[model samples]
Target: MNRNRAKWLTLMTLVLLTLTMSAQNKQKFKVVLDPGHGGKDTGTNHLKNVEKDIVLAVALEVGKILNKESDIEVFYTRSKDVFVPVKERSVMANEAKGNVFVSIHCNGVASSSPSGTETYVMGLSKNKSNLEVAKQENSVILMEDDYKTQYAGFNPSAPESIIGLMLIQEDYVQQSIDLASRVQDGFTYDLKRKNRGVKQGPFWVLHGAFMPSILIELGFVSNKEEGAYLSSSKGQKELAKSIAQGIISYKNAYYNNGIAHTETNVNEPQANTKSAVKGVTFKIQIAASSRVLALKPQNFKGLSNVTMEKGKKINKYFYSETSDYTEAKQRLAEAKAKGHSSSFIVAYKNGKQIPLEEALK
Candidate 1:
């Protein structure tokens, strides 16, 4: 090769290698640390004081540690004692391109006996207490009229509470769950606190976040002992360290596995709301020895409007009313898609099961 061509080739190769290394070294973890209820809005207060101060102290310490210890860039919603509305915090974090958001708060209940660390992610709640807690936490939105717009139009009622969660529609759901689990474990093992498993519910602060977000209630302020621990400097350091480590460990798993793609989120509910079609009457089974003629009127007189279809090696039954022609066709389509052609209904009339004829009228 000519000297000029050889020199150009060497330069091009060096340029390509540099770009590749830069892409590989790009930051994999970007976190937003939110200390719940600041300034005038002192969330839930104990005899010692409000939860706002406790969470801020912990969040500040956590952010400092994350910045000093790891390559992760931690964004804070508030750095000092100031009121940051729910809408503003979410907007600021998203603007900063945060990948994950962690909201820190202290749990509270009327009874001084209740104590534990509960972590919440956006979703529907099933329990009454959980629903109440959701409402209490979510009320922070009242401070902002545009909170609805801030969270990408998340509806507190019906489906809106669940649908807006689609933005994170990637593998982050499981990753968020894993991080929450680790934090709970850390609280139990390292901090000697009660562990509440990762829970799903609607939180105003989390509803609009485009990335994986979690709200952590680190022990009940209602309980005297727990409140005291949360107020102390040593307890603050311990709590912050445990939470930061959980995030580090979780992010390490993804980076270690070389997972560059985001996870898909299944936010929408399925159209088929589970029906309450009860009773053994709903189930129709056939006998192993039953023949196609078993579907005949005289053979199965008591059975009403039974439909049957000839199977490759067996017969199938269907209920003329509930499992009508249209439903049968849809199920057949689903079965065919799954490579299963033996998709048919079997009816149980009396004690015998009719096969081919039993599945059809």
Candidate 2:
């Protein structure tokens, strides 16, 4: 009997250990890092500094920094000088179950005078410059072996082709914009680099990512000074540090209830919550799904006061409602703490959902 008891105790201890390990693994956040353009696609070679090489160095450094974090699992699309198709890069991220996707690239222009760091979230845009950037990046598909079949008649040069592309990423637009804004802040405030601000553009690389994604234009490689700085060892380290900090800041805000533990300088501005709608009412949007889910708290991690609204192609679920903006922000925090990482405060006017900026104004 004594021997049997001892054996049972040992088995229970092993089971507990295994359970703990499994829980910790479940908590790990995966980040997919794509070092844009490689091999035959050198990407914007200018004044002896290649966009592909600079971005690869920066991406590797970012991965190194993120790897130091215990909860972050970093996956690189191509660690070495190897070409990866845009769609395949997204496929790798999806297979890895990445929480976020970041594609690193250097921008180039004809004049060589423009120099700044801009991040882009996938969207259809009418802006001439944004479209041009998208066109240039999307044009890389032509280099693929079976480009025609791979892209399915999508022409990079045609604006109409972009319109025909599926907008599956629209649900994550706000989250992507939030991260892009943080990255821009890191570049402008911490690194003292020019900030071109976050913008939306239809980039094929960002199109297929299921999670929040952004394409970072590190700096204009066409500019002589910027190109040299981007190519330098010191610049690469600093840029990597800034981008890493931004990622950490975003992770802290969304995943950890805004508790920051990283040492890098990251100053994320408070999300504007002021509303113009009189008798202002707010809600916390917890999830956006392609399929409509039943309005039950159990369906949303035991989140109470759940509501759903049907959109053209997707449905959005919101949790908690309040008249006070401060209370609404608190509710948003609670939703995030409950594993709704992308939850954001939404304002309503006369029972109709309105844009946050419009409500604010």
Instruction: Please name the candidate that would achieve the greatest TM-score relative to the true structure.
Output: 2
Candidate 2 lDDT, 115-138, residue by residue in tens: 999998887776678888888888
Model 2 scores worst on lDDT over the 10 consecutive residues at 260-269
Give me the displacement of residue 250 in model 1, in angstroms: 0.2
Model 2 gets an lDDT of 0.81
In model 1, what lDDT does residue 340 have? 32
RMSD of every candidate to native, in Å, equals 16.3, 9.2
Global lDDT scores for all candidate models: 0.64, 0.81
lDDT of 1 by residue, 1-361 (tens): 6999999999999999999887767654677999998877888887875789999999999888888754588889998788898867778878978767899998887889988888876655455556667767766665665766765665554344543344332224434554676677788888788876677665767756766678899888889988888888988899999999888765654342223332111111134522222221222222111136656534433444556645322234443433333343444344334433222332334433322222332
**What is the Å distance of residue 355 in model 1 from its true position?**
49
Which residue runs of candidate 2 sit more than 4 Å off their true CA positions? 1-14, 17-22, 256-342, 345-361
Which one wins on lDDT? 2
Candidate 1 achieves a global lDDT of 0.64
